[model samples]
Target chain A: MSDFTTWDILRNLLLAARWTVLLSLVSFIGGGIVGALLLFARTAKGKAGPAFVKTYVELFQGTPLLMQLFLAFFGLGLFGIDVPAWLAASVALILWSAAFLTEIWRGCVESIARGQWEASASLGMGYVQQMRHVVLPQALRIAVPPTVGFSVQVVKGTALTSIIGFVELSKAGTVVTNATFEPFKVYGLVALIYFCLCWPLSKSSQILERKLNVAHRNH
Target chain B: MNYTFDFGWLIEYWPVLLKGIGITVELTLVGGVLGVALGIACAWARALGPGWLRPVVAAYVELIRNTPFLIQLFFIFFGLPALGLRMSELQAANLAMVVNLGAYGCEIIRAGIQATPKGQFEAGASLGMSRLQTFWYVVLIPALQRIWPALSSQIVIVMLGSAAVSQIAAEDLTFAANFIQSRTFRAFESYFVATLIYLALAIALRQLLRGLGWTLFPKRTAR
Candidate 1:
């Protein structure tokens, strides 16, 4: 039997952390695009659009992500569509991220006052033009902090993908623990690596929130 | 390709599902109270308590918030035993859920605390309230009333998150699904039913928390 050193373990874990990074990136970016579509659908001038978006958000948000992964993995298999663990994990997280990102973007968009919309409409602007020229630009400012904060959540969300056999940092920790018989050291390093990934995002989110709230500070 | 669906397993496993729901409720209820309590304590230590303890509380909140609950669960369930601390799967899951929700709950509650007006403190002091009494009755309750909605949502998030605890063989709803799936080879059906139960639980829990919020903060909430 070959013995693994701490270096061997950390190196392997970092190797797996690469997947964690990749998965988070794919889900975040994919979710952003999908969330944008949901945002449009949500804000479009219709009764059905916003209601559908609400149900979409609630359906995704109300369920556990682990179950979502399982459903995507096993649910698809029932349709004779074989999916690797990573693919299923990505699809699930993307939907999960989209639901949250859509809601965040909706909140940001809704924070725009009615006057802006009315003014844009009074100028003969269509819905898209109003959103483009007036509402979204302002909403983007309020959106940045929470969006960045949610990225930390996205990164952390990747950790659960490990449950379905996607070998991210958490799964790597488990595998390394079995190999080295040192769970404390292995998982402590796991948590530390995550902290390194997330602390700066959280701190900057706080800083940005403070800066953004400067407008309200005077009141 | 053709496939037929069968829910016959569900009928046979009704008792298992109910047992799983019971365990899940137990986990959420325990985790919610303890977790929010931890949040209040941490929020206090950070906001208005001793200066020396601020950094420690900050680190605790950050550490728990950034890491995933699954890893935290693994760290406690698998990692802690190596350090001479051992616990059952239920105990470990409870601890992880508490710490995770506590970090989130701390941030939510602290926002409420920070938003309280400066004059409220003066009013309490003028009314002959000690610092302790003032903080408990004046600062704490009002802050809670303000943040109850956000806090209720956080509690529900943690409640949904309890579904992950079944990973450690904690015999929760998800664990029951896994068991039934293994026995019946109906993976999709099992998880679907289990996820539905979880969805129902989340919705019901949210409604219950909202009702609790209305009852608890009746004076603050206007009709």
Candidate 2:
């Protein structure tokens, strides 16, 4: 019912983009912490920890993130735990991101040769010490590219939070579309913003992979 | 917390849920088949096709890969009519999934194509095969064989991501959950059931794809 010029739309969307960036950062950082813990548990000596982490990762990965967000928003409310959209979105995205991150990191950690573990043990190094001293440092290097790459996923994922009523870029786009009746321009701009945010991360991930491989070859 | 869970709505809502599941599977089947076909074409173009086409294919792949599926769907469903391009919700959803999976599948298939041995191409040339013939009979099959697992995983991802189509009222499985919850006021139960169904679908799809891979690439299984 109001006139919205191109600049008006762009300004509103840009303002909302901050929430998108913040949510991505929160989920990525939180997911990384949780994923690291799961990675340790997954690689720990014993059956239970690894198995539990495996199931945890599988369950999260197997379902849609939208369903997860719905369950978080409504499921939490069912128990009288009134959750705001941002909290629900953050929690669901964190858990989902953690699942993928743990799996990605597990692959990286496992790629460290078995000899490294055996040699560390022979040197009287404990599991934690071997991981801390040798395996993780090496794994961290390989992990950087994919981790940065997955950050793009985290950013794209923040788009889903809009479905749960979070006033992020995508949601803002929808609201602006209603106000301006310009769904084409609004959604196109939304896609462009997402592309700008994600392409650099995707490109860097590819470059990092190539760079790391060169370093490995030179070694 | 003293919250009593009621799945009583299931009896009444079974048909709606069934229809939803049916649509979701239909979307997946159509999206998966057509998507992989488009991917194969793009992969060929990027990897082995003419010089002018590679950048064009690369730009499409990069654009799709870097954006979220939801915006793409919104663009197609809500945004496209401004240019006189119109489609039904279901059509838009299917098109979105196909386009989404094609980009991902292109990259995956390209990786496989890139991994092909240089000797294979020369061998094909010596066998009197044209470049397209060589790609078809010699390179493409083995490349697909090498990347079947990865491609299958991407399809599953695209299938899961299809849940977002419900935002446009496309009546997929997630839409079923939303419907049942609104009617029953059993939001958690409805979503919980839907989540489990998705898990089942994902697992089943993975297994089905694994079997399909073995059938398609018998040599892999033999080896």
Taking the candidates one at a time, how many backbone clashes does each contain? 0, 0
- For candidate 2, list the clashing residue pairs, or say none: none
The TM-score each candidate achieves on chain A is: 0.97, 0.97
lDDT (10s digit) by residue, model 2, range A42-77: 999999999999999989999999999999999778
Model 1 Cα lDDT, one tens digit per residue, A79-176: 78878999999999999999999999999999899999999999999999999999998999999999999999899989988888999999999999
Kindly give the stretch of ten consecutive residues in candidate 2 chain A with the minimal lDDT sum: A210-219
TM-score for the B chain of model 1 = 0.97
DockQ per model, Cα: 0.78, 0.87
Interface RMSD for candidates 1 onward, in order: 1.1, 0.8
Candidate of highest lDDT? 2
* Real contacts recovered, all predictions: 0.77, 0.84
